[model samples]
Target: MERGEKIVKRIDTAKEAKQNPSYFEALVELLFQLADDDFIISFRGSEWLGLAPHIEEDVALSSITQNTMGHASLYYHLLEDLDIGNADKLAHERQAVERRNASYFERKNGEGSYLQEPYYDWALTVVRQFLFETMKKVKLETIINSSYQPLADIANKVLMEQPYHLAHWRMWLKQLLGSTEEAQNKVQFQLEAAWPACADIIGLGPKAFELEKHHLIAGEDYLRKQWLKELEQSLSLPSSLFVDNHPARGRYGEHTADLDQALSTLSEVYNSDQKAVW
Candidate 1:
């Protein structure tokens, strides 16, 4: 269903990468940024497994979570193809300081655990997932013509499935916001909380110029504008959505204890014995 697939400029190979060090450096950085964001968010989604408001929602959410994690794996494998390391290790064995996901993704899905005292907020999930899925589509579109042909191919493959994810959350956001005052208030609170760090989520981290310099991806400013425009058209956003602070800047290796806690849980099975075959 992918239409008008562009002819991508594939990199010759890591062995033939004769460019200066910064080119590969930017490539790896971008890969980490893409992989880590999806990884953490999917982990968050896993936490919501079987804990959605109802069974049908739970099943649908699980499917979306699996798709997201699958996307992350595709990125990690891309890194592995670069001989960065094993994809499993990159996903599970890294220190929090080495990750590149935005901090908001690692935040708890409201308070309490899924099995006990499951006080997870559906409104927050609706808003956050809607915003993230929209942003992810924008990023993927920018990468569809990526200079790295392998990644461009993956982007095209992923673009086929991404619309469903965006639609699921967008429907949740619209239905909830229009339904009840309480639901709208809850979503509004999430929107306010998300606004401050919204800039970081859309940022290309510290190496934006280098990535664009090598024709790796779209310009960061252009990306930010596109993302913001899409968000404004979908949601009732403030006229001036200024980012005064970052809850955590994962791109710069800056994160919160939330990420630390998340890593421990996500890596529990893998870290039990890194050598064991799963």
Candidate 2:
């Protein structure tokens, strides 16, 4: 396949996808990236369980987290269908170095543990979720036409509920950014902090050539361009807010200690009974 050519054959089943080594490898890499990104971020969202600043937000965040986790499960199940591994094990057993989630999503919620004197940063949460959901919407839109039918199907299903999730965070971001000077400063600080680390979030990883050639999804350039266009239309962010530096490329199996801690907590119960069914 050429760089700009559309894939004519639709792979409707895992069996068909696995028939080609190159396609299979690219597909698995893409699935892991999608699945881990959602899985880790949802775990971070789950950390905000009862500490969302208000009762209503508490419930809303929880529901969104559940939905996001369900999205991750769907991706993992597709991986399972490909004979990669058990879905629960894939979610719980992966090490930090094995994870493909952007390191920005794995940063500790704040300076404290959720069970302790939790000092979570709501500004960071709002900014991160808003930015992530925006990029997610762009990526999903690109992949909805994926040559692999099952993956495209999952993208369509996720798109149905993703708008609500994006709206919730966008509302929070807009309100905070437009409120008092202190709130505006907090949001701005997070935006500045997150700007440089976002390169990896919109990236398609080291397998970019294979992913694009196989028509698994559009190229990284297309994703980044569309994401920026969407952000510009939706928010009055400065052009300086966007940078091309990647502090960490989780897609290439690079991560931070924050991911290790998150994994330990996430897999604690499942680790206790490895043989037990989830």
Show the colliding residue pairs in model 2: none
Mind giving the per-residue lDDT tens digits that candidate 2 earns over 1-278?
68995546789999999999999999999999999999999999999998999999999999999999999999999999999999998999877888888889999989989888999999999988988999899989978989899999999999999999999998898899789999999988988888887678888788899998988898888887888887775566666543767667898898888999999999889988999876
lDDT by residue for model 1 (45-133), tens = 88888788899999999999998899999999989888899999999989999999988778888787666787888877787788789
Q: Measured by C-alpha RMSD in angstroms, how accurate is candidate 1?
A: 3.4
**Cα-lDDT of candidate 2:** 0.90
TM-score for every candidate vs. truth? 0.93, 0.95
Question: After aligning candidate 1 to the native by TM-score, how far in Å is the CA of 189 from where it should be?
Answer: 0.5
Query: Clashing pairs in model 1?
Result: none
* Cα lDDT computed for each candidate against the true fold: 0.84, 0.90
Q: Give the best candidate by TM-score.
A: 2
* lDDT at residue 53 of model 2 (Cα atoms): 92
Consecutive 10-residue window with the lowest summed lDDT within model 1 = 9-18
* Clash count (model 1, backbone only): 0
Task: List the RMSD of every prediction in angstroms.
Answer: 3.4, 2.4
Query: Candidate 1: where are CA atoms >4 Å away?
Result: 1-9, 242-244, 276-278
